[model samples]
Target chain A: MNNIALGRYLPLNTIINKMDPRSKILILLVMMITVFLPAGFIGYVPILIFIATALYFSKLKLTYALRALKPMIWMFIFLLVINVLVMRTGTLLISWGWFKVYSDAFSQTAYIIIRLTLMIILCTVLTATTKPLDLTLGIEKLLKPFEKIGLPAHVIAMMISIALRFIPTLIDETNRIMNAQASRGVDLENGTMTEKIRAVLSLIVPLFVSAFDRADQLADAMEARGYDPSATRTRYKVLKMTNVDYFAMAFALVVFATDLVLCWI
Target chain B: MEAIELEHLSFSYDGQTDVLKDISLTIPKGSYTAIVGHNGSGKSTLAKLIIGLLEPKSGTIKVLGQTLTDHNLKAVRDHVGIVFQNPDNQFIGSTVADDIAFGLENHCVPTKDMQRIIEESAAKVSMSDYLNAEPTNLSGGQKQRVAIAGILAMSPEIIIFDESTSMLDPQGKASVNEQIRKLNEAKNITILSITHDMEEAAQASNVVVLDQGTIAAIGTPADVFQNDALMSRLRLDLPFGLKAAKAFQAHGIEIDAVMNNAQLVEALCQLK
Candidate 1:
């Protein structure tokens, strides 16, 4: 369970890691949109290069980036199989009784796979380079404009950051609960579906009880520290966009513009 | 000026029986006071009431010479900070630096001054190195130190520790106790520690013993620990030093009353 590295930050002194989280998030948004611009396979070359450059500057290993894709391999295979069976537009490649394969099937599957891979890689790079707190702050600053429409941006950001902070603690609690239940002869593994669900309930009930208790204590602690949801509060870690952040943002925008122009042409 | 004053304070959760009854206590400025009691003795409730976390049914609370009211509650909270029993629950920040910045941010301290204040507070608790570390990466003691640094950054006049060290190991407890004492002595911050450890209470300048939701005894640690009848009734044990001293006296050794192990050791070493 600890091996899950989807959104874990790597503490390294690098240009990508030093960029402002807001700019990083914006760049990520631009990259995600660019990947789905209806541009042909040839149009993805620039995006792939941009991602490679980002990965290089982040100082993160290729294995870590690929690890984010490990959990989605099964889903990718499922999508490929579905596309192969459904799409029959292009010239026929092979046919075996009821099974059929076509050129467009492979091309369409490739397009989707490329888009998903690019999106996932971009997200992983953002999370790996930026601390979770900074990500939350970036999201909060981005959402501030919506506050005029009655959206509680600060509260939402607080909830997100708190949830992220408690993930490890809750994971530890889940393991402890699982162990305690296992000691009591609860077989969570190698059980029927219904029996497994019942066993999971035992673990879940205790986890929920502890989580709610922690939340209560946390609320009191926040109150004691003078946290008023309605009150105006200052920020400590201000997000300043350095020249490099601007450069990163401009680079992402240019790539997106290039992809849009390719699709129009 | 008194750091905290409670007059005829009474509180009840379900409105039937009171958790704390007519609890009137005054903690003077710059004093290290310990509130010790059994699990249900309402000592924790008293701490909460003083910090304005819980509203009293019938009483008045004053912090730093200002009466606690709805309008002035924020002001009161600004002067008082609390570190609760569970280190995991009270840590609101993802990292140590962010946690220390939490209270300062709440009070609207400018971002420019916040960095310096956070560094200084982290230095006080010897956690400057771990400022960027996550809470999960910290031990129970380090988390408490970070929590203390969070409060210290706010520069509160009085800090309440509600069984803060009860969840820590012996070493963690000792280190937190040392930090609390230093904050009181060196920084002149008043400390009101709610603890289950008599040894911890022995180090305080004054001790308040709560029994059945009332102040059973309030005096210096020496004066309060000397009441054997009351201690027995409250089911509280003596500090390690006094316990050992009594055991030594039982075996034909004359030892003077000592509040802690250091004094007991000194007395034993000076014996002819």
Candidate 2:
């Protein structure tokens, strides 16, 4: 269950962790665009190096970062296999009846796997170091300019962060409710497919009720504290860019620029 | 100065039986008032009404001298904060610092001073070290403290505890009580604690007992506790000392006006 590692922040003293969340978000965006733009493998060398260095500096264990990719490992493998079987070009490596594997296919598959893995790892690195609320504030700061166009940047950022925060909480709650139901002699496992589905269906109503109840109380609490969604509220944890942020942003820009040049070549 | 005043306040959920019927109450500034009642006695509804979460059908609520209306409710809310029941549910922010900064942000506190106020409020609850800690990761009492920190950071002149400690263990409740005592004493913040806990009611400067959506009794705890018939009618237990004195009285021994166990014990010793 912890393998998702979605909202879990690994507490470690590292330079990457010390960088401002806005800088990290910017770095993440640039890295994502750069890694995803190029079709060739040569461009990903910098991203791989960057991710490896970031993982080392983050003080987070390699296994934990890998765990964040666990849920998508199957998807990555499936896509890699599909690409290998579907694309046939360059030199033929193997042929059996209707199935044929090619050198070009292998390389393309490898490139995609590396790109996907790198993207997931980069995201893991971001979430693992920065707290969820900081990410929200960072996103809100980044989205502040859109407020002129009738966008509720603060509200949108808050919604995203709240969803992120509640993922683990709601998972724990689901487990609790399942355990409670199980204690009452409800067979959740070792049943027919329909029975299992029914058991799972039983969970949705309670979970919905609890979620709505929480939402209602939260609204009341927010209102009691004078929250006005349309008001122009000052941010308490404002995202400030300092020297380290500048250095990180510059480093990211260089990586992105290099990736662009490599793609042109 | 009146911290809060409710005049002729009546409310109902289904527009049927009035949950709160013509309730008139006044809490002076810097006073600790406890509203106690059994479950579904409308004490919580009254807390909601006072906080402007629920509007009464036929009366007015005033906080810090401003009457609460649809237009001015937000302004009044700035001066009054509420820590609700269900510690997990009331937390709107993910972390301790973020939650405290929430109200501050609403009040448009400058970013430069937000950290100081957040830290100061956390320190009031002795939770300064857990600024980055998630609300879910905290204990029930710690979460409640963080919620209180969120409210206190706004410097609300009046803070309402809507059965905030009902879900806490005895130790947690005691810690929250200690923090509340400090707030009332040091900051001169008015407290309106809605609870059914007899021990908490006994400790407050004034107690208002609600029964079936009406004020059954309102006075100093000593004065209110003296009305055993009303207390019994509301299905509220007397504090241990008072219960013991009553038991002794049933056995032909008289221990009158004993507010606590120590007093009852001394009176028994003197009689012997």
Candidate 3:
């Protein structure tokens, strides 16, 4: 199912892949903030173009890149429909009783869709460009100073990387288990939602049992190999932001600032 | 100098009744030794103690003459690498190449040397072609090889395998065994494997049988497997080839020399 692609999707040798993931994340934040600038085509067009270009540079194909839009399709439609019919402002293209579709509503709908699309594409760029481990490392680096106040930034970020690392493994295991059970008369996909839920119970029990078994074995293996989460270990793969990363981030920042100024003007 | 030496070592997780008691053994430099024992028989605990993964409740464990201690734990790890029973657990990286590089990275080998070390280690295990394959994409045999490559890249003086091949099928196990034997023979790296398979132990230069956390027997594979009561107690089932050889010996068939399957086969062929 190419579900393994859900794990770290970075191309191994790209220059962008080498950028400190923390820097990529900062650019994502800036772009996300710009998405909410006052509703106008003038504000959104730039963010969308910028996000598209960022993703393109990250080596992700635009077709697969746009699937990020699938999850938001219903929300976008709902927002556009609601804004056009319920807002009732400016020139009316159509009016039905108290409801009206205005020219302003059309502009607002375009603004919301563009903003959502841009923000989604920006996040996809971050994920597509950065290795999960590097992203976790970047997060740890960004949050390191707050450690003095009792936060476990490295541990938390490492947890995210571990979570990301295991997702594909778990999905594969789940599929294998499900297929095995299906062969044994477990009607997981053939029943009502409630029945399917019950059918999954058979699958979950063994999965939980195996998962715990695997975890304990892993704990023993890790402990045997000198894996101490609390111990400060040396990094083998260090992340350093290059001049290009800085420029890319700076470019994102400038675009955000320009969007804000236009919104105000 | 001994690669690993243990004297009267005993351990219990709760610090009460000993799990491994009065266990004394020494592994010579570059010896390929196999430890066979049933569940709860302390074979793995001994391996853990040798590497300082677990502290002994009593007695001494020495690796290359330095005594095992909490302070030198990292130092011990630097000199030793362990592959666990479950290949799923030991993996620290997403891709095959990345996993192989993990230990080398931990030792902080420079980046330029890392790629080559990874390639060589993978090649040693016949995994060079799949360097970029995700760990999740590999089979059990391949995963164990990746685990071996991880440890091999560390260039350890001693490598321990704790039933690492148990989950693998016959072909997978044989491929892994062939690789390990080559490493032990070629690199002079000491190997201490804790396995349930007597056939694998038969291939080793020596076998250590553990029962109830004690060293029940220590000798060549023939010397150890001939003790039926001791073998049964330790769950050290003899490999079929060896069993057949033993049966031929009981049939009043006399041979000047006998060893593994091929040797026994040759002994039978002499009858013509």
Which ranking of candidates, highest DockQ first? 1, 2, 3
Q: How big is the positional error of residue B175 in model 2, measured in Å on the Cα after superposition?
A: 2.3
Provide the RMSD of all predictions against the true structure, rounded to 1 decimal: 1.9, 2.5, 3.6
Compute fnat per model: 0.99, 0.83, 0.38
1 or 2, greater by lDDT: 1
Model-by-model lDDT, in order?
Answer: 0.91, 0.84, 0.80
Candidate 2 per-residue lDDT, tens place, B1-272, comes to: 59999999999999888888999999999999999988888989988888878878999888888888888877788788899988887777778888898888888999899999998989989999999888668999999999988888888899999999999999999898878878999999999999877777777899998888988899998899978788767667887777888888999986786666667788889885
Winner on DockQ (1 vs 2): 1
**Once superposed on the true structure, which residue ranges of model 1 sit more than 4 Å away at CA?**
A61-63, A92-102
* Candidate 1 lDDT by residue in tens digits, A1-265: 6866647888897998888999998898889889989989878998998999999999877777777787788988898889888997999999999988989988998888888888888888998899888899999999999999999999999999999999999999999999999999999997899999999999999999999999999999999999999989999888889999988888999999999999988
lDDT of 3 at A121: 69
Give every prediction's interface RMSD. 0.6, 1.1, 2.6
Model 2 ranges off by over 4 Å: A60-64, A70-73, A93-101, B262-272
- Which sequence of candidate numbers ranks them by TM-score, best first? 1, 2, 3
Worst 10 residues of 3 chain B by lDDT: B253-262
